[model samples]
Target: MSSQASLRPAVVLSLVLVVWALTGLTHAQPKASVLDFSASLGNLLPSLSRPANSSRIFYGVMFDAGSTGTRIHVYTFIQKDPEELPVLDNEMFHSIKPGLSAYADMPEMGGYTVRQLLKVAKKTVPRLEWKRTPLVLKATAGLRLLPSEKSQALLEQVQDVFDESPFFVPDDSVSIMNGTNEGILAWVTVNFLTGHLYAETRETVGILDLGGGSTQITFLPKSKKTIGSSPDDYIARIDMFNSTYELYTHRTCIKYLLCHVIHRPPYIIVLLYTPGLEWRVFKSSCLPKKFREEWSFGGLTYIVSGKPDGESYVGYKLCYQEVLKVVKDIVHQPYELKDTSVFYAFSYYFDRAVDAGLIDRTQGGMLEVRDFKKRAKEVCNKMSKYRPINPFLCMDMTYITCLLKDGFGFKENTVLQLTKKVNNVETSWALGATFNHFQNLKIHR
Candidate 1:
């Protein structure tokens, strides 16, 4: 099995090399004789001209830099139709021990460290036509939180390995933008799954993306009508849409708190898309310091509020005094809490004595039902009054769903999975990043 596995990579490598050789030969031939060569090259050459359809599919390296470690995805675009962008030959490279930080003291997570990652990629994709197909290095909250010097040092290290360097080495800002794009794409795909395409040409769309470290909510008003009828229709469609990604600390609330303690944030917020049930995590700077250890609903519960006498499925029993104390401590941090008037509203399936009458209907809105959009607008409008100085937002499923509904105004029919049933999503993060080989990728000038 070991020998066969080793041979498998070699065979694949050899095939890529042959394609490179053929590409070189084809380019060397005169432009006029290209038609004559087509007759000989046959159907294979047809795809060669367009890398999207070629045997040498366009490859992309996505490193979701988190506070603890970086999750890297190496995949290729193998979809034939633009409307259907799929991924192929996908593999994830993980470095769990050492975080994405460039500090020399940390333990090495993988054999190929961050510095070595670029070198390995350049070597692995030997004939990678960087000019035609550029490699994108996107950082999320990890890069954002990294000191300028450290981030630059990491980028320089990666840049050193490139022969024909990548066209774009975007900063955390760009990563945040891409993260937003991914969320919007997921929302659109969800809409597609529900058989609800755009109801109006100038339709309002909201996108909320929860990643390992950060969570972003993008809200767009009615815009002009545009159609993507080309081969790359799907990307065009996504491009036409606007996006905003909220950056938290890292992928998990635990990591977010850890990074937050040191004044760091994750690079971007990504919604982990899986085959079965979907799940999302909100960026909560308010996540208790206790979560720095392993996360548990109980730990999260104690931090947000004091100990509860009985279990109430949605968050802890409301102790206004206790919850207020915690919120005050968080408010004392460097960044000023913006809108003092905007109230912090806790949602519940059933009303408790402390929460029942306290929700200020005159000053703000209180939500009880599952109408997501209605609830979100109330929070956004109410929160706006507070003038929150920090970008970080704290929310549970009730708030998150509201944000996804009202902040982004996602179509009502968007598929939503119950929190209790989140485990139904069969594919784990490790599997999607490491072994999934059917994702569609693309490149544009």
Candidate 2:
């Protein structure tokens, strides 16, 4: 949400902040301890005097500048005990579509979106608390995919807007969030809220998040092999809840050749890929036979479609073979993922499951690896029934199945609990990001 410090991003800070928020540090202090700011149970922060009997209340404002939309999260935290962590009391959320990147050529318009979202903070935070409530903005795939000059121009405009706001504007308040931190933050939100971070037995669930622009797989591996076998960049040693965890996380992007050109979805089969990509037409068996069109996203045009009529028989078999090639060596398989891990999947994973009647739309339920396989088979084979609802349903469903089985190497029986939110908070990086920045936890990377 809002942070007062600027330091090298660390997975440790992201995981530890929520624990500090929910349960006061009962365990050992993190290797990455809190900032020098004084801690008190009260309104505002940093050495503010308060009535001894009054409870502590803190406010924060975070703006998520994502590819599809810009969302604002206004969080209220309360502390009733000095020895325990602060409890998340309430959250006020809002958003605007066609993210700031759409206004790259007209930077002021993008500033207006940030300006408009600021009003939510103005209303939610008490008048006297405005000066203390920190405001921050972190852009994701949308801005990161833009040219450096254009992205910088847009960020400058956002800065001007932040300067005009009444809330606290920390250093480096507006910037693009890297893919690695994005993955770690999502893991923090789910694990912290789910009560795993505080458990004495120390069981934590892995997180799978798929957006239109990126996908993340994050979990604490039980075996040293999962850590040693992974590429260095894919493994992060994070100190949290008084323990050190070597996490295996990856965010994917489509850059490989598919048919000669690329089928660039800022994500799919889900991911963020190599930067400085060239625009090209893409062809794949990932679409319906009757589907063919020029699609545009993230300021680039991509021509995508299923295999031509009569060219090839398209089914889950052909689709998996086509999609499997993208993640062969790119995604690292964790040791004993199927037997040793508990997972919660969200984002595109949830939406597509709901779309295919695999899970309830309102209340998401537990699903196994084979459930997705079963659903993928039905959709990929019966395109005529599902295509009108979403032409990409077959492709996306197929991608989810393949990625889970092949990319992550989960057995067919791996159970995945998919949810859109925990308690009332969204199951997303925003809540975790808020804590990541909200607390000035600058742990060593």
Candidate 3:
């Protein structure tokens, strides 16, 4: 509950690095390891620190602290590239299993903790030497979901690890935005690689990034330039398009099933693909009309029922009756349903050993991959005719879009798809390029 303003700027700033180091303490080794991926850092230097000084090497670090473990990214900016820069030399990324209880004990982090993180970081990269590299640490939704005091204490502890405090807390908003931005870049990168949008296709692209706890959709506008009369001139200028991040929407979990269901902290879902029945029998069906009225959302509930055999979900029949019962219970609560919501059901992906055919596919129509789109389109049309306005939009992350609009040039009136993909380990060279520039700069109190 302590106000950051009450603390002296020096103290506040000093705590930043200290807390960073304390969090690093959780990276107890043997159980923990670090991975580094490289990227071009030339453009990102300005955002990390001031480039006015011709002297001093500037370095930056991106940290992802979660409930399970922590990951750190180290970036360097060299003094040679004072203003206009390109081509970063080195990048490092790593993960550490810093024990949870270790962080809980600290009243606040201090210089000692930072030294520990540095030691671990150096150990991971034996050849590398860090002198006066500035470090920035950020936490994720895992830390935010914890108790306020615990979270603040953890932050304060981590702050003690650095010469300067971390620039920001790794809130869900930031994570969602980061994932969103990365998704946009990834989609562009993938599309460019796939030859979807080439010299001929000059249309702007939109990226949708849906993450574990967040969703982001971005719009990037790019323009193509035409040069000489030579037919190939256009191809030369094709890759030289001017592009900017236009619009993006970030959606983070406010009240999720994890918070609602068994409050053991983490809600886990095991996805098992059982391939036995046809695709038509495996398709999901709509909730009953009355069930829709019973719940806050007008949209029908689509359920796929399965039983967990140990860690894996196995041996299942698509029970429209049972699925409808759950949905009806969710909608009407105590009210008993006269007519069930399971109008249709599928038998696809059900374990062959424990399979019991429930619905006759010929009698009651089933969904297939090809016809699913048509069914969805029909549903959309029907909903539009009845509801006119989609109510789900009201529950999305519209406020965050407004915040990034001016900063990133987001636009309005665009429909975007959001998807999330896990990246194994990729380093951004930008960190090393930027950090190397100021690695030797001493912090003045």
Compared with the true structure, what per-residue lDDT tens digits does model 3 show for residues 359-386? 2322332222223223323432233232
- The lDDT of each candidate is 0.30, 0.70, 0.29
Q: Which stretches of candidate 1 lie over 4 Å from their true place?
A: 1-56, 79-97, 102-112, 115-133, 163-207, 211-214, 218-445
C-alpha TM-score for every candidate: 0.39, 0.81, 0.37
Model 3 lDDT at residue 304: 27
Q: Decide which is better by lDDT, 2 or 3.
A: 2
- Candidate 1 lDDT over residue span 1-445, tens digit each: 0000011111111122233334443332211221232222222222434545333345445554544555444434333432232323333343343455534223232223554555444544445433333344444455566567666665554444332354222222123223333334334333322222334443332323343333433222222221122122222222211222221111123222432312222211211111131233322222222222222331342112211232221131221222232223121111111111111122121111122232343233333224443443333233333223312122232334433333323345543332110111111122222111111111121
Compute the lDDT of residue 237 as modeled in candidate 1. Answer: 24
RMSD of each: 15.8, 7.1, 19.4
User: What lDDT score goes with residue 93 in model 2?
Assistant: 79
Candidates arranged by lDDT, highest first: 2, 1, 3
